[model samples]
Target: MGLVVSHLSIDCTDPNALAGWWAEVLGWERAWDEDPDDDEVGIRAADRSAEWLFLKVPEAKAVKNRLHPDLRPPDGSDQATELARLLALGATPVDIGQGPEVLWHVLADPEGNEFCLLLRTPAQVRADGD
Candidate 1:
């Protein structure tokens, strides 16, 4: 049998708070049935791609993230629009030496975790059967 991913986990200083922020950003809901002050929190996608598991850790992020999620705009939306909305949700632009040569916008979540807001390519749109 092939291996399957149960969830994507993130280590943070505050699990509940970070989960809340991501939930708002991704339109996901809390999947954990724990107290508001729990050291671990979960956020799940409506389509069930995979849930995000956030666990509280004592250490802070000190370097660039090796693995980051790249988000594509929904069928009806564009990158610029989504980027603006994410900015309103506390995402900040991060310069990680990806200058003008790159097409993706590098942004960091509230916890300084780097993620990319990718430009939707024709392939993705076509694959969506648009």
Candidate 2:
């Protein structure tokens, strides 16, 4: 049998809060089994398809993240609107050496982990028109 990616994991100072923030951002729900005081917390899509696991770590973030989630605009919104909404949710813009021609916005979560927000694809733009 082949392996499949069941979840994406994030390491952070506060797993519970990070998990909650991500859940709000993605419109996903917390995995009912997780507790606010747990070192590990999980969130997943309504269908439980995109599972995300957040783990607490002892060391603070010292450098750039090696891996991070790249978020895409949902069905009806455009990238700029989504970016503004995320900023309101406490995501701050981060400079990761992206040039003027770069097609995505680099942002950091409250704990300073870097992630990208890509511009909407053609299909997503079409969805906006619908």
Residue-by-residue lDDT tens digits, candidate 1, 90-118: 99999999997787899999999999988
Q: Show the lowest summed lDDT stretch of 10 residues, model 2.
A: 121-130
- Reference-based TM-score of each model: 0.90, 0.89
**lDDT of candidate 1 at residue 26, scale 0 to 100:** 87
Task: Give the poorly placed runs of model 1, Cα more than 4 Å off.
Answer: 121-124, 127-130
Tens digits of per-residue lDDT, candidate 2, 10-59, equal: 88889988898988999999986767689989899999778988889998
Candidate 1 similarity to native, TM-score: 0.90
Query: What C-alpha RMSD separates each model from the true structure?
Result: 2.4, 3.1
Residue 101, model 1, lDDT: 78
